[model samples]
Target: MSTTDDFDAEAWRAELEGYRDRKDEFFANERQSPIPADQRDAFDGLTYFDPDPAYRVEADVTPVESDETVVMETTVDTEQEYERVVELGFDVNGETATLVGYTGVGEDRDSLFVPFRDKTTGQQTYGAGRYMEFEVEGDVTEAETVTLDFNLAYHPFCAYNDAFACPLPPEENWLDVAVEAGERLPEV
Candidate 1:
């Protein structure tokens, strides 16, 4: 996998197109979609911020070992516990910031769940937060360094309709900078 710092414009463009196409299919489909059934008719496809190669960052990953579990609140008013699997430190525009990556407590995890909020919240992006998850075998322990493609960050399921419950990003994962990438606010 390539980091965004050495972004290959041509490659990133192709990947972005694939992402948009998949989302378009998901939103347009009546079944197997997170979008509310009642609102499906009016859905013209989900909105997104222009893909920016700059949003992708290479992060240093550190494994977290703690007895405590993070219980995240969901839009449905319920809470679920997830293990804080890794800590990611990266530079965003000359400033150093850190974010936590979570994983479900089970036999094994195949992905890193990164949910975060930025200054763009309530304006350019979702007021609640945005999510980015990458397929990883086991945990970040396998690799001390990993790539965080923020350009693929996306609005939660609840953004489309309230029926689907989505986890809220913890305050610790919030960023002070405006991440003008990925999916934008959904039309209601």
Candidate 2:
């Protein structure tokens, strides 16, 4: 939930680049990688938009009065249930926007899960959506605000291989602006 106002741009960019490098190494070497085993030999790395501080945004967290159980459709013919927990309000390219954060139904997690689709979907990014999660320090209900770093947004495993089924971003989470940050199409 760190703010980017006083962030060291060089350090942030370096850290992000290091993360990307590690991820590439995992994809190319790990057996658990999302890239199909048959395609692992040719796997290079995931494409990414250059890291930009502008994509790191601060969001106002508004807890939901009644936590609603929502069934989200997946890339395949399956559904998963999640509890709608909070609304995250932020700005993107001068446009104010909101996205809902959720958690697995009947599960207590240390982080809030946010899946979303922006104008970059089906073009520059994954068609289904990308995901970002931030660790909650204490009770999420008591949180006033959190940071939504699009620079850390990433495609689900399904994006790399169809064998994996990932939840689609709810319609309410579809963004109108193009978020030109984070991982793009897989090179598998």
Candidate 3:
């Protein structure tokens, strides 16, 4: 059998090769067509293989509301930007974070945005919020407010491409725990 040192060297080389292949394919797919929906879901389901696993701790839910609004800004000039709001909510740990979502014309129809960051940023996961798209459930939108689950967080396209300009996670959204779920930046 191959020695442990030899096995490690082979694994490192394989990882590097995989990263390069992924980088090439990422740009190619971006240029070619919209990423397939199934492919997107697959990426969204990725889990971190942490050398030092730091599982997410459940925190108490803290009710929150949105107070800021801005038009969606895009690096591509041709596409139209929509108005969005930066809302606030808490994790199971009571750590505060921002949610990014759409606002409707009528007061009752507005949706909530919940972007967040965690200790996994830049190390085990993307440095940006793992996005979780949510809509208000049931009749009571105030007291029955929803709390975000970091297991559903994700990285923006910018995580893969330098050409993409994704909004950075706000300071409040940054968490102190290692959120160990969702898509991770490919090894490349």
Candidate 4:
């Protein structure tokens, strides 16, 4: 993980701007997006908090050893199975927090699925939670470390429409402090 001294806030902001542009395009294009065709006319853009570098943290990541397949509850009544692969311990504000990173089966088994909630839920951000994905390769071991950038946290597709089924963050991933970065309360 990159230390604070090595973290480039300006570059991160540029990357985030690029992400926002792509997301805006995706939302505007009803043919390939979750936004209903009828509502495309009114779609402005996703709401987001100002880019704050303080929310980017370097976490001590440790891999979990278990044959466990957790039954993750989704937006709808249906539930899905996810493998809890790693635990990331970090600091937000003045408090310490830990979030679990999971992985899907088959093709996505190597991908990192980081879903979480903060004190901002339902008020300042998505009612359910936010998600972050790290396109990591190889298995996590004792020496693994990760960057937990809350500035990249995003709402699930379900936030845009009801037709989608998004997996909700487990109770363990909830943080007590307000994470004042990343995507804000999305207007649907």
- TM-score for each predicted model, relative to the true structure: 0.90, 0.94, 0.48, 0.92
lDDT of 2: 0.89
What does each candidate score in C-alpha RMSD?
Answer: 2.4, 2.0, 11.8, 2.1
Off by more than 4 A, model 4: 1-4, 186-188
In the range 93-179, model 4's lDDT, one tens digit per residue, is 989899988988444545688899889999999898999988765665444677778888999989988999999898988999999
Residue 40 in candidate 3, Cα distance off native in Å: 12
Highest TM-score against the true fold, candidate: 2
Per candidate, the number of residue pairs that clash is 0, 0, 12, 0
Cα misplacement distance, residue 48 of candidate 1 (Å): 1.4
lDDT of 3 by residue, 44-94 (tens): 323334321122322233333544444443334323233344334434434
Query: In terms of lDDT, which candidate is strongest?
Result: 2
Winner on TM-score between 1 and 3 is: 1
Q: Give the C-alpha lDDT of model 1.
A: 0.82
- By TM-score: ranked, best first: 2, 4, 1, 3
| Tens-digit lDDT string for candidate 1 (1-188) | 24545667888789888979888888878487887777688778778877776777889988887757888899899987888888998987667889998887662567889999998888888888999999885546768888888889989888877888889999999998888888887545
Please give the CA lDDT of all the candidate structures: 0.82, 0.89, 0.47, 0.84
Order of quality (lDDT): 2, 4, 1, 3
